[model samples]
Target: MEISTCTEKMVQIIANSTLEKSLKKTLKEVGVSGYTLFDVRGDGDSGDQSGHLEGDSNILMMVVVPLKTSQNLMEALNGYLKKGHHLMVFSVDAEVLTPSKFG
Candidate 1:
């Protein structure tokens, strides 16, 4: 058996469910090929996110991309923060298989 791994950046964003549509659009605009999304619940400085209500829930979006693309993604997400939206965004080093799929 043979395997290969490539260096990539994993971008994770946690935001309100109401922004799902806009967020998905932003991802495509930033050249992200795909992403994983989950309806998540947690407690943080913003308090408890129970994810039990329609528009009051939270979502976790995770995408892997090239380092440069990751920077672009963060810059785009920053626009939301500037507009007073509550979003938690960050990126980390990642090793991924079939890296071509993530660009």
Candidate 2:
């Protein structure tokens, strides 16, 4: 058995649920192979949306991939965010248990 550290990039995206479809489309256009989206609640400059249901709340999306792909997504998201969409993106180095899955 052998194990080795692999460099991986993971981007966390928290945005309004109203951008769900558009976000997914952006992910595809940015060439993200895999990602996870979840409903979330939190407070920010936009106020609290926990009380309302559906669109009022937020969605959490996580995409893991190579650095190149991550940069592509971030670049696209940068312009999209400037349009006044409530989107926050952050990235971190990830340890992939199954490296082949990401490739």
Candidate 3:
């Protein structure tokens, strides 16, 4: 199989459930279309984020987007982080199996 040069990335977002709305809005504004969300459980610098309960939970979101869109989302995320929202974002290469689906 040949690897395509799509410049796409799998953006992973882990944050408190409270930040879900803001995260969704930013992703939409940054041109991200599809994503997979999971109620996750983990501990971090802030504290235990076991998404076992409604209020005390965490959200894990993964989205595939072009590099430009990822950059934009990263920029917009700074403000939320500054406000002390538990957030983390990472971008990695995305292998394209169906290019048309992304366009």
Candidate 4:
């Protein structure tokens, strides 16, 4: 059983709603339906405030998927992220305790 994990963060953007929709679409396209999201606030790599000064919101999302589905989802998100979207993405190997959770 192969597993993959992904962590993504978006900064200074009101793209939560759009991001959620895009994520869902990508997940469905890749046959994945499970994910988790959290609200986050922090400074960026340049030591700039992450929207705190401008009263914006930041969100972090994590997704775990079977290896077979990970590539496809990544491909879909790549284009979305390239459109000047302020975001970061990283992936790692993972093990799922509850296999049924993905279903």
lDDT per model, in order? 0.92, 0.86, 0.79, 0.57
Question: Each candidate's TM vs. the true structure?
Answer: 0.92, 0.89, 0.83, 0.64
Taking every candidate in turn, the Cα RMSD to the unseen true structure, in Å, is 1.5, 1.7, 2.3, 6.5
lDDT tens digits, residue span 11-71, model 2 = 9999989888999999999788768999889888888979387677899999888888899
What local lDDT score does residue 4 receive in model 3, on the 0 to 100 scale? 65
lDDT of 1 by residue, 22-69 (tens): 999999999998899999999898888997777669999999899989
Off by over 4 Å in 3: 1-7, 100-103
Q: After superposition, how far is residue 69 of candidate 1 from its true place, in Å?
A: 0.8
Off by over 4 Å in 4: 1-18, 46-55, 100-103
lDDT, model 1, position 46:
83
Q: What is the lDDT, from 0 to 100, of the residue 20 in candidate 2?
A: 85
What's model 4's TM-score?
Answer: 0.64
Which predicted model would earn the best lDDT?
1
Higher-ranked by lDDT: 1 or 4: 1
Candidate 1 lDDT (Cα, 0 to 1): 0.92
Q: What are the clashing pairs of model 3?
A: none
Task: Kindly list the per-residue Cα lDDT of model 3 for residues 49-91, writing each as its tens digit.
Answer: 7666676898889988777777887888877888877688888
TM-score of predicted model 3? 0.83
In candidate 1, the residue pairs with backbone N, CA or C atoms under 3 Å apart (3 or more residues apart, or in different chains) clash, namely none
How many clashes in candidate 1? 0
